[model samples]
Target: MSKEAQFSTDKFRLDGKVAIITGGASGLGFNYTKAMLISGAKVVIASYDEKGWDETSKFAKSVNGEVKFIKIDVTAKEAPDIIVNAALSKFQKIDILVNNAGMQRRNNSVPI
Candidate 1:
């Protein structure tokens, strides 16, 4: 067998990979964090809301993986740089970034 095939499982693992996920403290972002952690990738969860951080922490503990939370709002002009710096500070290098921060609200005054 070829070397590639021999280490297929190793290739699937994210042993030395780091991922940055925006709005990862809650909702779909939270789910993504769990998945990546289970896959062996260290994750940095960036969010403006600190409330959901507790949940993320608990999940991280249960999964026994490395996860960190950084406060950020993607709407701001400096948000990109802030996020990049945060990732670098924590993980040294960022291998993945999930731009999942967003909002959805219904205008009750408008008729459907």
Candidate 2:
């Protein structure tokens, strides 16, 4: 065999990485945030819900992960710049982006 290593064990390791996760405060987005944080990446959670920040922050603390929260409606026009700036200011760089922001509404339908 050649002297090159075939596979290293750090596939999911995100040491020294920075991640921006849109809608990362709740639902499936929150799950992604937790995973990345646990993987050694500093995460910036861009969420519309201000309350979510508190909860997410607490969780980050529990796991001893670095996390920042920015309140922005991802659907708004200025949202992109806001999120990018937040991440840069906090972590200095962004290596991963989990663009998982989304919304859902349930409306009752009337029979025609």
Per-residue lDDT of model 1, residues 1-112, tens digit only: 6652222334467777899998887888887787787778899987889978887888788868888887877778998898889889988999998988887678654477
Question: Using alpha carbons, what is the TM-score of model 2?
Answer: 0.79
User: For candidate 1, what is the TM-score?
Assistant: 0.78
Name the regions of candidate 1 deviating beyond 4 angstroms: 1-12, 105-112
Whole-structure CA lDDT of model 2: 0.83
lDDT of 2 at 32: 85
Worst 10 residues of 2 by lDDT: 1-10
**lDDT by candidate, in order shown:** 0.82, 0.83
Q: What is the lDDT of residue 83 in candidate 1?
A: 82
Every model's TM-score: 0.78, 0.79
